[model samples]
Target: MPVDNHDHDHQDRFEERLGEALHQAGGAYETDRRALVAAGETRGHRLLLRRRAAVVAGVASVALVGLGGALLVPGGDDGRQSVATGAKTPVASATPKASYTGDELIGILEKLLPRGEFSSPQARGTDDRLPPYAQVVHDDGKGKAAVAVGFDRVLPGSEQARQTVECPDKVLTPYDGCVVSRLSDGSALRIFQGYEYPDRRADTKLWTADLVTPKGQHVSVSEWNAAAEKGAPVSRAEPPLSPARLRTLATAAAWLGVVDAIPVDPKAPTAAPAQPSGIDGGAIASTLVSLLPKGVKVVARSGPDSGYAYVVVDDGKGRSLVQINVQPNMSDVEDQLFGAGAETLADGTKVVTHKEPGEKGGAGVVMWTADTLRTDGFRVVVSAFNSGSQETAATRDAPALTTKQLRAIALSAKWRGLG
Candidate 1:
């Protein structure tokens, strides 16, 4: 996989500490419900949550993985229950876990990313240039599994600390499985394996773990780390992680301490004057889609804002919309765009989301709101939404648009019946 060493280095630092988390989980509730494992058999670190929250389908869900696909799903609301303070406890069992084949770890990994295949770790003698951050290891037994993931040369720090400013543009281009790009959160993940990388090596296992241990089975991360130390030159490949598991990784402060930050309210209603309107929904959706930057698409749209664009689409599944907006203004649309820390553009475009009032967790459309006076007399409002991912509520925002430009886009979108 073509991962940035900078990202790898950063992940390395964090993973090193990941070992200590084991002792924390060892103290309590070991007899509580066991980890949702794959049938039976296990190895490596046992994953149990004293309090693990599942991603609510509506508010926040898992997202597409791979290179380029690894972009941050804008900070938004999580419908899950509020978090409880505490680390997960290991499974309770007076008996020490008997060493088993490495299948148990493999199974946990398989669930974490079911789309993946199995393969041996990289052999030290291979002609392939191994990633310096490539450290793939697992325990033979002890029941439980945790893949010690790593990235090469990539910024190794908190997701918030590293913004997208460090990545290159072509990183997102095709022809390569992984394209490095900045995300709203600041951290950049190289989509390796088929997720995003050079070889797309739909051909390497790169990911490994032990078999699933029986439900009562569990192990600590520190214990697993010590055991994995005995293994060397583990495979280095981009492993496919389950969207759900990936969500846990992204939101878990322990792994990355990733917190969910969303602009519940708008940036405060802008002082900009309202423009004309009349462009219907169809016209608005068509024009907005046409005007969007490449690689951007529309997932959802609304009617025109009284006289401005009124819809936002994180992943443009189809067209755009124009509608009434009731959310507060976003702090800075452009800053949120182009990933975090993005400076204002020369055009002075304002990106905003049309959120439901009093709503929280970034649930709304994000687009450029605009109003234009059409020749027909019906004024129209339009919003171009084509940022973020489908899994995030940030898609509903629409801002930085004007009536005039919206009308132009609407004009182009006007349906002319074929003769």
Candidate 2:
């Protein structure tokens, strides 16, 4: 997968906040900061794949991750009770001394679990300068399982928060079940049962619960049948936790203080402002459908609000996937996206085409793209895949639409009105 430096920077901010929170919590658990950052970058890249798939589903308009809150200390007659369902501990204040240490947080998590034998436990405390994380290998006699919890925040009132709790479009996410609920405290929670990968290429089942407080504190918990996220063999019928337990773990009041202790980084760059609004995604899909060659038939399309749209079309041969991105005032990067070998129209529109192997690595799949930038900076780039989805094997010999047809659609005057 390609790494977007801008997105990587955003992920770094999240990691920094998490590390700061862990350090404030004060724990014996410690690891090299460089290793942590490297691991985070790998995970962030995988997450971007999911985020991009969400975009195709029309739910992700803005970037998804952000930072906020401090750490929460375990509290109760017994620290474990504070994390139990219906425990109702008071929300933690912003004082660092009052929060639980990393060791205490891990103990609290262990106590909250059902009867099970836990091994290979790992945790980062509230006082560690690394993102807070806890993982345990659990065996209930039936089988061993892996469960983990992570902490972070969302940009309040942004599309990121909304997408965090929104149930994914089934076609894009391929989950067995998913539900989104609102708590009495006005926090949003979503529980999803799905595969570790969206395409279900592997048998590792992933079940996750995500909670976002009204104030932007975000907590996520995930479990897999295998001991690791990938490669490990499935060790049980399903993940160790039920949906209700997942919710309780994510919303535990014990985390509130830790979230409160996370100090914002003065040196971190402010999130880039949302790009200048673009033409609606639905309009783009509709226009592309309208311009399809006579024999081509549109099968499915995405909504207009996503800034990009795709259509599955068939033309007697087989189904193919064609997608387009529409942007306004993108002249700043025209030189980079369209380099040498580009063609310039009499009207000052620059066009470029490329035939490359599929990005998803689907066998025998090919991608043909047409990119266009007008004199006024309006840009339209279109690409077609020989497969129905980039992640799947090719369903046809080639894209349903030829390169000439794609270029014609990209350069059409109709796109100018979209600006």
Candidate 3:
């Protein structure tokens, strides 16, 4: 099936960073046809695993990472080339023809899997409208599992590439085990054992091996205990493939030829724009701490460089998590984020309060949010959770701060200094 764009866009920072890195590395895929198969596999794999993890913990910190703007390029037809917007030159001449079809690539994947009975096979050819991918339900005598493999690229020496191989902070992302290592061939590789949901509310497990060659060839292999990534029950204790097997699949030579067949978009490198300037996380956290109500004791704080900050506080009762995001020039999204129910103050500041369930679906965990926007396009949104992390159990019956207090803090004059 074609990848879901919605799900892809909402992936956690780790996956998104990897995607950006791959795009940068594969800028020359089209012109270099000597290794077409590898290119195709690389591109398809990147797209397929776009949202492999969206609800992971510590995503707030990850969002603070800076990235450049990106220019999206639509897939082109067989005989045509899609030129990137703002290109100063014409599209380059046709490169070598792709040697392998999508099915041929899938055939290569099937051959690489360990001895097993494969069923529910679905494969996309290299020439297909959507990025190509191969998926199957493999039974290795123990249980049936979903396994998939695809290809992508990353720019060597780019910030995106450097961040791609970095391990997620354990405090922000709770994982069973994660390893980053350099292969003998000098390729950077990461193996992660993590749950599909950061909260581990379900039994679904996702394991992946991400590899990027020095030349920017990217290959990712993923497996799950369920038949599908979501809406499926866990079929076994773990995925069918082991970390060793996943590494073997990702580093296979067969994929290199296929990756060369994948077309490259001239705009891939230009897609990411620079990060927006705003208040530093430390300042935001300090400001919030100073504005807290008396008798509330802060136990911990997070967000140093990010524009968002959070603190764990106790109010002679239980612990609560309070977080805030400070953004500038956000008038463009004012209407969408704040509706007609929002109130306007004498100072022309619009404010809205929301009481909703925790984003991670933790049982009995509630969230209270106060959103405020000044006429000058300054936005301050503060939220409090009954729990320290959305992935964990509720530590308090309610957030330490009331909605009124949250509203007051969000609209404080102290925030104007950040401007």
Cα lDDT computed for each candidate against the true fold: 0.26, 0.62, 0.62
Give lDDT: candidate 3, residue 102.
Answer: 60
CA shift of 362, model 1, Å = 24
**Per-residue lDDT for 334-407 in model 3, tens only?**
66666778899998999988887765566788888888889988888888888866567787889999999999
Measured over all alpha carbons after superposition, the RMSD of each candidate to the real structure, in angstroms, is 20.1, 10.0, 12.7
TM-score per candidate: 0.23, 0.76, 0.71
Stretch of 10 with least lDDT, candidate 2: 35-44
- Cand. 3 Cα-lDDT: 0.62
lDDT value for model 1: 0.26
Residue 113, candidate 1: Cα error in Å is 16
Which window of ten consecutive residues has the lowest lDDT sum in model 1?
50-59
- Clash counts for the predictions, in order: 102, 31, 41
